[model samples]
Target: MRSSGDTRSNSLRNIGLIVRREYKNRVTQRSYIITTILFVLFSLVASCVPTVIQFFAARSNSQSHITIVNNAGTTADLSGDRLLQYFNSNLNGSTSNGAQIPGQQASQSKGTPHFALRVDTSTPISQLQKDVKDGKLDVLLVLDRTANKDVRFTYYTASASLSDTDLTQIQTTAGQLSVLDKSSRLGLSPTQTQNLLAPPVFNVVYTQKGSGNDSLISLAGGYFLGVIGTVLIFMAVYLYGMWVAGGVADEKGNRIMEILVNAATPFQLLWGKIIGIGAAGLTQMVCLVGAGIIGLLLQGPLSAVLQTGGTLFNLSYIHTSTTLLLLLLVYFILGFLLYSTLFAALGALVKRQDEVQNAVGPLTALCMVGYMASFIGGSVAPGATWFKIMSFVPFWTPTMMMMRVATNTVSSWEIALSIGILLVSIVICAWISARIYRIGILMYGQKPGLRQIVRLLRQ
Candidate 1:
């Protein structure tokens, strides 16, 4: 009888050969290279979409040109020139060409000032109205007093479809103007008006403390990265898992699987193919990660070149920490290994490449549960009881746990527990898949019934 050591050595040798064959065949394909490149390009483009749109939106001059006619005349106990300065200071907040003017409060609205207010007392109201109608002026502001001597502003715009932003902003300025005028009539001094109109100090502070590398991650960026990380894991599992099933189905359809099975035991073949495809998938993932890093590094220059001033979408929220990265890699591998074995087994059961999608539909659905749940759970409550429970489930552990990790909400024990469960689940899955694959590869005809599948597992 052959020694157990010799049998073990032979199995290792056979597995090594199959692994090399499968990996080389997968990575060397033109389809594989093209798909990887396309996915990288698509990822970069998708990530930059918000920045690109902001650039286009900013290209247009959003400034409102308002020609003002101050007919009420020194109602606030100030000269026309002083009223002009007040309007300018309040509306634009003393910014020149997007640069902050010293000794001036920055505009309440983001970016450059919204309204460029200029006195046009010399010009006839008819001419100003005509200018507004002809689009030569953005708006015409006719300032007058009501019957009660209260300040009133009548404005005309070129288009009725324009946003209410200008109207609302001007109303704020006008309201402030009325306040000053009223304060003056109440015998209040300029210092008291200044004190009364001053805005109170307000700021946001996060009370939660970060643990270890969590402090290195951005608050908003952590959530954003969680989203990105989850996406990367989901795509890797879904795409690469399908590839594994399709590869096996293709081999079976071409009759190469019979030769492969004869050369190696089904258990060895199962591991070899899973590991091989996993290696190839890992290669693709590395490229994706590199591309993601490069894309993130380029965002600063991208924002500068686009002149977006980093408003709306802030990439700073994402801080890629070494710990988060290592955890992602670990979870990514475990996730793929766990799913790909099942995909490979399903591939063995399918007789044609065309049937692969249908055969693996259930696995896809299962994978999607975690995939979609991570998005909702991560956004809603990464530390919720339900989320924690789901994260421990082997099928979802890769995705949901990573979300927890990215959010910096998970403990070391939780990580260990989830990983431990995943490793165990993978072992059980691989053994079951090996048996199914051994039988399914040789069974070339009608689909096996549920009872036969159960019997094969029992044996």
Candidate 2:
């Protein structure tokens, strides 16, 4: 008989061979390559969506054609000449009254008129309405004077939603004109009227300490990290766990497990498959993350070209401390191993590939529950007592702890304690799953009941 040391070495060699075989077989598949490339491209495109929108918005001609119908006649305080001039000035990126609006910066394309204004005294109101309906005119303004010496303005448009900026400009112009007319009657100087209309400056200061005094950019970055990390972990666990289950079921259904068991123990097969698949998944994730980083790096230059200022993909806000990164990596690996091992054991109990889904349904439900809880807790109450307690539970720790870390609410001691609990749970799960996997892989034909599995595990 071979020495125990030689046997252990041979077992390790066999496990390595299996891992290499599994990894190579999956990675070389056309589906894997195509899917990876497509997913990476999709991530890159998604990050640049804001820049694309800004590019189109900048290039498009945004001018609105407006026609004015002045029914106030010559006796009214509202002059058609002044109204037309005001509209033109405001639409052409200037304030009414022949003055540049303070603090108003021109758009990338300088002097692009936002509205084209024309006074149409000869066109009938009916014709103007038809023009608006036919898209020949964007807006029609009808000006009249009330008996109380107040000017009345009415607007008609074919569009369902009128531009707020356009409406605000018209309102401000009318109000200024009315004020000027009254100020002239009261013999007030232009300077006094200007002072009366100018907006007042308001300043604010924060004095509270540790009151979540983070900037909006930093908070947004933290939220993005939490959400993206949660989604990535969830997808990796669920998708790769199902793959492990389906792969095991496929091999068993074809009676290939009998041959494989002779070459290596069931425990070796289980871990080899999990590690190999996990590595493959990690490879895909690394590619996706790399693509995202590249996209973020390109965003500044792209924003300059597209004139979008800046977008949420700004990397300056994301905190990349070594401690946080290490914690994320550890949590993800432990979480993957925990779920994938359970799936492998369940896969062994199934007699056919079709039964894999039924065998893993409970496990999938458990994962979904943890995922939903983490999302709700993180978004609704990150610092709630219940959320803190759930973060210590093995099943929920991966998601919940990652969320807390992303939000900067988790302490180092708390992380250590949660990880300790998770490690213990993983060890226990590995032992139980190995027992079940060794016996279940040999059974076939009829699906084994819970009692039968328990009895087999005892043996």
- TM-score of each model, paired residue for residue: 0.86, 0.79
Can you write out model 2's per-residue Cα lDDT over 337-446, one digit (the tens) per residue? Answer: 89998999999999998988888998888888878988898788878889989889898889889988777677778888999998999888888889989988888868
- What's the lDDT of the predicted structure labeled candidate 2? 0.78
Q: List the residue pairs that clash in candidate 2.
A: none
Q: What local lDDT score does residue 297 receive in model 1, on the 0 to 100 scale?
A: 67
- Tens digit of per-residue lDDT, candidate 1, span 1-459: 899999999999998998898899999999999989987897688767777877877777587898888898885775576676667776766333322221344455556766777887688999888889889999898889899888888989877865777787678777877887888889887667777776666555433335543443365677777887788889888998988899888889999888988788888988888888888988998887777667766777899887787654444567667888888888888999999999988999888999989888889999999999999888888878899899999999988998988777788888889999999999999989989998888777977767888998988
Taking all chains together, the TM-score of candidate 2 against the true structure is 0.79
Evaluated at residue 98, the lDDT of candidate 1 is 28
Q: How does residue 1 of candidate 1 score in lDDT?
A: 89
The per-prediction tally of clashing pairs is 2, 0
TM-score: model 1 vs. ground truth: 0.86
Local error of candidate 2 at residue 277 (angstroms): 0.7
Please estimate how well model 1 matches the true structure, expressed as its whole-model Cα lDDT.
0.81
Show model 2 residue runs off by greater than 4 Å. 1-12, 54-62, 67-111, 117-134, 142-152, 162-212, 296-313, 317-323
